[model samples]
Target: MIEGTDNVSREAAAEAAASSNAATILPGATIGILGGGQLGRMLANAGSAMGYRFVALDPTPDAPMGQVADQIVAAYNDRDAARELAARSDVITYEFENVDADVAAMLMSESYVPQGSELLYTTQHRLREKRAIEAAGVQVAPYSEISSVEELREAVERFGTPCVLKTATGGYDGKGQWVIRDSSESDEAFATLSKAGTQLVLEQFIDFAMEISVIAARSSKGEIKAFPPAENIHVENILHLSIVPARLEDSVLREAERLAIRLAEGLGVVGLIAVEMFVTRDGELYVNELAPRPHNSGHYTMEACRTSQFEQHVRAVCGLPLGDTALLSPVVMVNVLGQHVEPLLERLAVRDEAAERLNVAPKVHLYGKKDAVYKRKMGHVNVLAESTEAALDWINETKIWKV
Candidate 1:
């Protein structure tokens, strides 16, 4: 089990203590979700099985979560709709960090939002997120705030070539970022990104051995539990695969879990927080980013761990005891992007034959998305095996992804 820190601030400790005394929301309560994406769907599915009802708010009429839970088809900033959801729910939580911070703050003011808006506000913006991580006694890649092309060039000179420039807010899955491999590229990158009219941050790229994530769950009572580290691989900046029991030394993995729990305490998170970090060749861990909700890298936990992250999130927000996060198997979870959906469906149609040909049976999950646009996340497949290598080998043999 992962141990939490003793260094939390007095105010945070008091908040946790007070929250601990608050009423524990049992099953058969309504859970209000702020976003109606796949995470919301999965959370509803998990909570529904435990006898809880769910209401989701999203702009799309046919949002994925709408298929499983009661959905409010309205813009995230629609105050009336948010109010209606709050009135109908016993507690409110968001599935994604990009939800409007002001809306979250409004919900917190009038409803039972276990995961407060402060964490949401801090994480949605890259600059604030990095500073918060550093303030938590965790190290992040060296970075400088940039406001103009000149500042960008100066930062490039200071950090050297191969630095990254990213928008302060609103970008994910490889969007809203530019890699400046040479000083000459700074102006162009700046000019292109600055048009978005948002503040930018310049980060010194780290030459890390591997990227890993620790999904930590913290209840309002301050109880914390972290799942096993997941070694992640990305293709074009989008997560492609997450392998459990990250291929790192035990000591490093322990340090990563410790840091994650510490950060959760520092931020006063009441639900799941996925901490992405870079492990240097020298075994140093540097926090890369934070998601105050379920993360793509944590998809492996649905089938690999004793408790899925979805169920854990529900427990954390509803003031229930955190479930055991022990790893039950060595697993590899490969994403099925939009382009691969048809091929995956074809394979699924001949399940027995495909399993025989590949010599492995992978548990496939498809989000009920209507369209299959290129690069869009359609679903994922979890391959549990005696070894992660064997699972990865099966994924390769299938030739679904380049691996």
Candidate 2:
């Protein structure tokens, strides 16, 4: 819960609630963002172009978004700081779903937060998120809730070996999860994950042929638009590449989009929601996870689509009409991790010559992050080509990142 929220004056809360009823937030309104990460940075960039000002609240001084927007360096649950942000902005939104739900609810009551806290609460917990997906008439991997080692062992035995045990909350980027290939590993996996969170879930390991993601935006007026699916590849649990127009049967792509739209409407989202799915060898789709903001996989839309996800997010949260999500080109987005930053920089030094030599030009975007740690996402490159395979081949030929 946000500290000192009870101190808010009744008159102030009433006024904020009134302002939130405005049908649309026009340009020139100040937008407050909750997380000051790369997603917030990109959101600020898009909003700025549309004549909006930004204020960000984050714990990190000079965070990536703080580099561009006015930043209040404070903890997310700081009531005073949150009130300051609410007072200065016409609308508020968060960049990530891991934000404290209680704080988000406080902000919603004190500011115009189109994307409400309920979505955050549901998506932040894996068990709740999976249940929400199932409620939306979408298919998710079969899972069971576990509260103890005995429960986990029982669930694993019921589901069979080669299942996954994951904490219900506070896990991302391959963290807080263990794959139990054999029953022997259940005790260790349970002991390790229980330290992170008491609530756990065990899921059947899916033998997927490929992974894909669809980013959909929904406005307060109930307008929804979905972007093309992007086939994603991960290396060591970090996103490596996102290829647009996922090489799948047209029927499968349609089903993926249909599922995304259904989930978006069912979730009643007022902002962007990225739905990641697993495609089986038999062409079945299973919902893997959901992200309630701009996604890593949707980065390809920046260069390959008529409307970038960043701008679309601004449109969605600001109560404006959703933009056209038509694909403009076949594109591949490659993540530049910490290990590739130096090499990428060296190549960038000779970028013109490299483009000339490779006969492919890649648009590079680097987040102004201070450190270059292993597997940390430093930036991404979008390569638009005649085909997804051609763009992938260009990445391979450049050898900038080990494909």
Candidate 3:
């Protein structure tokens, strides 16, 4: 990973020097957001509530994030757009990590891109991300680099079968990656990312008992706060569900938190850092990967927490102290994916809200997306229960999402 932000540090420090309040962003200040997705929309909502305006930069003007922001700049990576956005905003932050560092750097050079663009340079590339995680004293799966057929063959021979070959950069939601179950799948895996050339890593298959993620935020001043760990389930490489307070041993839970703080401190990272980890059958924690922004796993925090991650994100980027990261209720979040437009309650047959139902479930959050395709993130429902089993039952009944 990129060790230090030599050039980007000056801008981050300057932006940190400009703001220090945590409760709210100053009125009328425009906060420039890099990506125009649901995360950006939530940030815009929180900013508006705080009397702050927002300018969103995205290639797709129709993206959900821009719908709520004050102004939309219809350019994703255009340096010219970055200059214009930087000129109008008091500070800038990104909702997505895929924002071009050069473009982000351009904005920072001119005005402010709080949190700096250094983290993105490392996270946008998987190889650097793995390196960073390991450097922070975390154990990653056994892996090797692959740039050619010879390299792939070597990696396969060295790491053995059932290894996953993934793009070293720009792969997400099951994209730009492959799981090689046997030697039979090697040729196809090579053909898939042939266009990407040398940007690939061969990872060892873990006999993992569970997958967990830590969504933590770090202010530009180096103060850090992390949300409770959440367990995740994936189907076809896309997130299927997430349950907070994942059924883990106390020692393991403490270890997860320790690893998270170590990683944030090691990177000197600013803003939200979501570290995905694998817990082996032997009760060992292994670093799976890292996402340097509000992660999909933390989406449940929107309703389950005292302060949503989006709000905390702004606080961190603005150099404010993070709010209390406590869980008010035992929440289990279920994803409403695929092509079903049924309101989640109706879909789950949960109707009457008159006399306060005793066995009532949790809250639901639906992204305002029009089209609903298979595996598409239409929305999600958060179920608060007296026990995990009760919540799981409700989730199973509500699983009639788009097939």
Candidate 4:
């Protein structure tokens, strides 16, 4: 058994052996995906470029990923559907971490899954993920589990005000989280979140100088490669922009990459892992969280890196040689939320200055969704230039993208 990981069941070990032995699932084979979101869509696009077909199992009908690949419209927990998906593909991976790990384990009975279920299990819950990071000798925020109102109060007292309270599971994009700025608001926040009947974790909020994320990929052959760190800006918990080659001291950048690589190896992950980190005003670094798949912060890699993260994930899971993660240019990727969709579409219909300039050159990707809801990610635009500042300036100049 690998240190810092849960003991693998006999069934899981057999699956790993089968996968490792079947190394080099060359192009033209099908790759099965568990979730069909934007990440899956991008994954399918990358896999298609390599002559590999993709099939996704997601509950949402006509999901973004489904638009690009064959899809099985089934709940992630449906064992029969999972089995069918595994049987039809050369190997399997997931787009998101929220998929049931038990289903992956069931698939392990026969199918080969390079990105094992253990990573999904560890990262699905906030407390478990933090524990795993700490066990790997990584620094994380001080946190405590809160199951009851009293426990929540106690944690609030210990961590003090301005700490964050988050559900142990099923939370993302700022959902299932509350910022407790005062002791008095603890009761209300706890009551509101507890209504969902889930355990919560109270975390000490670090006053970080900046937010950054590193997207790293590990091949089945144990080769690891990391993209340049991306400085992230979030609006109401949703990523607004990602600027590659983050403005940071050289030592800090190197440390971020080192920590990310260390975490990926410690987890024994074969696919991509995005490590989110916080660099304190005092220059101390702390692991914020882990996403065991391609990350939104890495969207810039599509145009800026020698190997896009999406393609890297496909290569890693297929047992192919890992691609170079060298940066090709400074880029800024800005998320296009649903609220901006209408304005963007309207602008594109006419030959206005914004539209005309965008015609000169634009890298707009719109996810085909049925409805436009505020704060929901509809798509993104990547601006590449000589420098990060230049790219961001161009992005800002695009009036239609000023969401």
Give per-residue CA lDDT, model 4, range 1-403, as digits (tens): 5555555455457646755675688999999999999999999998899999999999999999999999999999998899899989989999999899999888877798878788899999899999999988899999999988899899899989899999889988999999999999998999998887878999999999999999999888777889999999998899998987899998999999999998887787889999999999877899999999999999988878899999999999988888889998878888989888887777667664642444323467887877888888999888776777666666677565555
In Å, residue 342's CA in model 1 sits off its true spot by: 0.6
The most accurate candidate by lDDT is 1
Candidate 2 residue lDDT tens string, 254-338: 8899899989877878889999999999999999999999999999998789989999999988889999999998899999888
lDDT of 1 by residue, 1-403 (tens): 2246454455666775667675578999999999999999999998999999999999998899999999999999999999999999999999999899999999989999988899999998899999999988999999999998999989999999899999999889989999999999998999999988889999999999999999999987778999999999999888999998799999999999999999998888989999999999999999999999998899898888999999999999988999999999899999999999987887777645545654555999988999998999998999887788888888877788864
Tell me the lDDT of model 4 at 199: 83
Worst 10 residues of 3 by lDDT: 351-360
Which residue runs does candidate 3 get wrong by more than 4 Å? 1-27, 343-358, 399-403
Answer with 1 or 2, whichever has the higher lDDT. 1
Error of 2 at 171 (Å): 1.1
lDDT string for model 3 (153-246, tens) is 8788777778899988777888888889887778789888877764888898898999999888888766888898899988778787788778
How many collisions per candidate?
Answer: 0, 0, 0, 0
Per-residue lDDT of 184 in model 1: 98
For model 3 the TM-score comes to 0.89
